[model samples]
Target: MLDFAIFAVTFVIILVGAVLYLYPSSRRASGIPGLNPTDEKDGNLQDIVNRGSLHEFLVSLHQEFGSVASFWFGRRPVVSLGSVEQLRQHINPNHTTDSFETMLKSLLGYQSGMGGGANETVIRKKVYESAINNTLKNNFPLVLKLVEELVGKWKSFPEAQHTPLCAHLLGLAMKTVTQLALGERFRDDTEVISFRKNHDAIWSEIGKGYLDGSLEKSCSRKGHYDEALSEMESVLLTVAKERKAQRKQTVFVDSLLQSSLTERQIMEDCMVFTLAGCVITANLCIWALHFLSTSEDVQEKLYQELEDVLGSDPVSLDKIPQLRYCQQVLNETVRTAKLTPVAARLQEVEGKVDQHVIPKETLVIYALGVVLQDSDTWSTPYRFDPDRFEEESARKSFCLLGFSGNQTCPELRFAYTVATVLLSTLVRQLKLHKLKGQVMEVRSELVSTPKDETWITISRRRKHGEQQQN
Candidate 1:
């Protein structure tokens, strides 16, 4: 089911693209009046594409088109909610992570009975969350070991040299997730490398399907995606079969395999999360670093918080809470960078948010990028200011649609755990400096990244002459 749906989406998208080329999409709104907050502005495919960058384009749409608007991606109609109230009304109760429960069910092969509301599934998710949280803490040593290697390499770099943060962070996230997901076998460096390549291929193809229409037009590209997926599933299935009876196993895949779901369902979810974690977590880590490097004051504050809390001690679960400044920095980075720019949810039932009437089965997208930067919600929405999060009310009042941990992004806390550990460990040893040409520009995708590779230079902290012992 997962495989078919993946290909089916690609095929349908391609067909739609062809149809649009032969016959341009009409300007008339398929949705109701207030539904298009854009007020029936320029939502043509030509305009969205002509804007060059979709992220910038959406930002413009919200600026020009009111807070609510409807648009089309090929034949698919989409409604974007960009304001705090609009998002709150729609997303607070109606938002979902990775689309709605039914989509997740169908894509992940959950039987009709299991759903987001299902007691058994909910219990299983909670159990997995607890287990994973504990494992991340107990497993700090593994994370630190990797961090030390990265730190060592950074310390080796000459002053003012550039380092590819995206590549490094992606590697760190992939290794950390795999080691936890497939223990013992993680030492298989060759297998780990294979997973990374295959993972990147599929993720890239999915992103490309929307931009270049290659997945729909090119059979070879689609075949490549299929092949990479097969390789990934084989690795996951092998790990699951090997560790099925290993009660000591406690990674994500192990938890899913132990659940009441079918074997195929477990395998699909494992594959989805493995790649999902790498992409989103990698983006988060790199963006956090970018924000830190750009702001010397914020960097010092983060370093001070680390020293004040840990004082050269290795980062651990207990110390995580005290890293308040670190948490604020991450929150600020995600908001400023708009790491998760776009997420869509299907309106299962006809509903109304404010004056807008949403029809059943409509795709309601929340432009987190727009909401995260709303002038009404954020005092200086465009600025990179972690201190804004200094006020507890800031985080509470403003709903970071896609980054919120509740339903929009279930993996946020998980990403937070991974990011906090990485930041605390590195900030303790090195002072992050932005490279000469490296500016943090948002390159939006499934998960956003800096427009260019975020290059940063590292130097031993002035205060900490010698690195403290773990």
Candidate 2:
């Protein structure tokens, strides 16, 4: 009996040793690269996604890890590219796999059933380019018309102690975009206004839910989002149906109807395009105006450029080229504010960059905000200097990644044109001032915008007598 017990004990010890030796922990003896599993604190991945400080965290990581760094977001490996050169190489137009729709579907639950196929993508790009070219040819009259409408509405308002300029600007932007896109205005339409309100609310909630990773929750907010999307689709479908019956094709929606897509497909595309254009362009205009309100020198310089080129005559499409400074100001605003801060793509197939193989299905984010503000690439990176774009060399370096990149969205050109028109019209007419010492605070959602209740006061520019005295 004693000999048997000794043998069993020895066998058990040997088995236990073998098991420990073969375990994964023992094999590697360390955590995986880009993933720190042993850290007691919340990992950097959680820090970036959940903490709501992605911008700050990315900047810090870039500072510590150079232009390229590997990080994980919820067990998913994320490779952040911050160099302009690397970004340019990666954003090849031929890589249709890295499309905006695909990325957005993953991020925001947007479904692109309209089938923007490879050929469709090419055609869409041409359409957008044509639209922009047309805007450059004919936007001034449209701009003046929109501005006149906005000024009339502003004048009619009670001049209350605090007029919500953000709301007012947003309304104006929506009207202007709608007019430009469809050649029809819906500013005062009750149904359109309600649609705008609900759409904005739902989209804002969706953005918050996406960042919070709570989109799956079947809560009241989710219901709101569902309802908003349904309502928007219904409205768009109704429009499509009516236009189809009339056989009168005019605007973007009409063009979409004429495309090789079904009515439902056309409806969905129209909804997405219109909603995106309205929201982002509106927020951009608001932010740009907010910035101009604080910087008197910048505002004055813009006014001078407009006045010098326009010379008391209403701005014309022919005069857009002469407003070069206006374009610089708008470009600077986009770079500094970054309406769409982070653009994402997915590796459809295995690819190698500098001998580092990215496996299939890797998520790649080109941090545009970081790249635009990189000190190495931009001089006085933080300062709002529009003059940087005045030189051809500098302009080439400053990539407006808003349009025609791998992650390009279809509405970018339209947004740019609308912004240019709005800025030109407003700066030429009004001297904007922030109320007292109130500073604008930025809030980032689908697009970056000012915090709630942000206000700016506008007064007409003085005559030459007052200007000379000042």
Which is the leading candidate under lDDT?
Answer: 1
lDDT of 1 at 54: 54
Global local distance difference test of model 1: 0.70
lDDT of candidate 2 over 73-143, digit per residue (tens): 54456676677776766665325533444545565454433355556655654544344345434544666
Candidate 2 accuracy as TM-score? 0.81
lDDT of 1 by residue, 145-184 (tens): 8877877888888766778898899888888888876776
Q: Estimate each model's TM-score.
A: 0.84, 0.81
* Backbone collisions counted per model: 3, 0
Candidate 2, 453: how far from true, in Å? Answer: 2.8
Model 1 misplaced regions, further than 4 Å: 1-48, 95-131, 211-213, 398-408, 464-470
| lDDT (0 to 1) per candidate | 0.70, 0.64
Candidate 1 Cα deviation (angstroms), residue 136: 2.2
Q: What is the C-alpha RMSD of each candidate to the true structure, in Å?
A: 9.2, 6.0
Q: Best TM-score goes to which candidate? A: 1
